[model samples]
Structure formats: structure tokens, C-alpha cells
Target: MFRRRASVVLLALLLAGPVIASPPAIDPAARNPPPTIALSHFDRFELQPVTLAPGLETHKGNVVARQYLDVDVGERVPRLIEPRNATPVQGEPRTLLIQPEVADIRFITGGKRVLFGGFAGSSWALVKLRLVDKATGEVVAEPQFLQHANSIAAGYSLGAADKLMLARLADMVASYLKTNFDAPVGSAVAAAAPPMD
Candidate 1:
């Protein structure tokens, strides 16, 4: 009977061990602090037209890519980052100038994507985003974002895949700004900045 009791207790202890050792659940907000405090200081935002890097001037899709980036990001910022608590700016409204420059792009044609899928290589774009304070002429943040459309399923949508990737990149930029700008000042650490891509 003692041996049986000992075995049962040991089994109970084994089952409870993991439960006792488990860490307490942490709040999601606490884990991810704001990425950039400088963004929070602005009352308004002005997005410059997206430009191509010097070498990309002759790229086939340069015009389309620039237009997409400009439109998508411009539309998304107002939807995502605006309507937040506004920090009062003295005299002129504190505006953040957002400049996105495409560093590189590899666009796979819809026909090729449909026929060859991943073998045609993924459609990707690398954009360097610079944020500047209009009032102080201070450069706030410069982050690089690389976005890709790589799903075999994306081939079904053909040309829409590249558009979707561009849209997602815009969403990411807007979301990042919203997350960082909405947080309380001093709450975010630079080391905890969200992944660029």
C-alpha cells in the first residue's frame, strides 16, 4: 500500500512539475514596445512621391512600382495612423516628411509567374524609407523594408501578386507607424524596433 501511494504521488508530482515551472503569461503590449518615439511627436504627415534609386531609373517597372508605392502608402497612412490622439504643435503643425526610395526590384512577369511559378523567381522590392521632422529639419528614422511575393498560389492571381505585395508593404509601413506613434513617450526602446522587412 505504501509503495502504491508513493508511485501515485510521484506520478502527480511529475504531472504538476511542468505547471509549476511554467512562466506567467506576459501582456502582448509589454513584449512589443513602440518602435520610434520621434513619430509620436508629429501632428501631421506628408508623404513624398516614391522615387527609384539611381540605377533603377532605367528599370522596366520603375514607373509602376513608384506609383504603387506612392499611392498605397499615401492611402494607408491616413487610414492607419491618423485619427489618433494629436500632440499639440505650436504655430505650424509638426509634420513628418516621409520619403520612400526604391533601392532594388525584381519583377516577375505574370505570364512567367503562371508558367514557371517559383522557378521564375520571386517578385521582390527593397525600399529605403526616410522620415524627417519638417519643423526642425531633423531626420527621425530611416528604415529599409524588403517585401516579396513568393507563394505558388500567388501565380493564380498573375499580375495581382505584385500589386498585393506592394499593398502589403504599404500596410506594414502604416502599421509600424501606428504601433510606434500611439505608444506613450519613453515606452519604446530603439533596440525593440520592429523588423523592417
Candidate 2:
């Protein structure tokens, strides 16, 4: 009888061991976090044409005007990415280019200037940008939308406002990539985890 009871107790302990000793359920968000692409992994940066805006025709006769906007925005990307260990190469590895599409844009020309019709009031520009892997043509991350506006009260000329708008667009792209794609390891995982009860 003593032997039988001991055997029964041993069997019960064995069955309960796994149940009691099991680890706490891990947060699923922590287990499967968003993907991050290191900037160092990419070889270079490319800025594509501004697609989806109505006034690109304004650049029809002026090569300089088009180039000015493109160069200004293009140059800003490398300066922003390099500090984070990414180099902007003209060729090599795989170029990660930003494809910008204009979502919305408005130019509030108030009145003609005293001499010529200078832009009077304000201008608005909204752009959406996404990262594409030049090699695979795959969009590696979510699209980012950003907007900027300049008012006459702020004393910004139309040209200056346009430049400012381009700057803001570059800023948005750089800021988003830095925060999402270049986040420190484990930081994203920790961020996804739920609070402890």
C-alpha cells in the first residue's frame, strides 16, 4: 500500500511540473516586432522626380528651375543619412532611392507685385515619400506624408517658399527613416511590448 501511494504521488508531480514551471506568456508584439533596415546596409541614395504634382509643367521651359529643386532636395538626403553611417554613392552596392509623389499643393498668389506679378500671399506643398530598394524595386518601408506652407506674413517669397517646401520634404524623409528604419536593436522590441501588470 505504501509503495502504491508513493508511485501515485510521483506520477502526479511529474504531470504538474510542466504546468507549474512553464514561463510567463511573452507579449506577442515583443516577440514579432516591425522590421528595421540599417542605413549602413544601403550603398547610396537617389532622389526621384516629383511625380503627381499639377505644376510640373512650370518646369517645361526652364531646366535650371527643375534642377534647382531636384538638387536642393537630393543634396539634403545624404547630409542627413551620412551622420548615421550611410554613404551616398553615385554607383555601387544597391541604391536606396526615395520616390516622392505630390499628394497636394496650393499656391496662394495674392496680387501682382508693383513691377511684375510676384507671388503675394502663401504657398502650400504636401508630399508623400517612400523608400524603394533600387536592386529589387521593393518598397522596404511604410510611406511617409509631410506638408509645408509659407505665408506672405512670414515674408517668404514664392521661390523661397518653394525651397522651404523642398527642405521640409527632405526633412520628413530623413526623420522617418532615422526613427523607423535605423532604430537601435531591441528598442523596437521593447516598444512593442505591453506594460507589465
Q: List, in order, the clash count of every candidate structure.
A: 0, 0
For residues 56-113, what per-residue lDDT tens digits would candidate 1 score against the true structure? 6665555667787789878777664456425455786778887878767765555555
Q: What residue pairs are clashing in model 1?
A: none
> For every model shown, what is its TM-score relative to the native structure?
0.64, 0.49
* Leading candidate by TM-score: 1
> Cα miss at 7, model 1 (Å)?
72
Compose the digit string of candidate 2's lDDT tens values, residues 1-197. Answer: 99986775565434322222122233424422222475446766676675655644453312333344456556655565555435345655676777766544443322221212222333444455667788898766544343334444323353555455555555555555555555523222112122111
**Model 1: lowest-lDDT 10 consecutive positions:** 16-25
Candidate No. with top lDDT: 1
RMSD values, in order shown:
17.3, 25.8
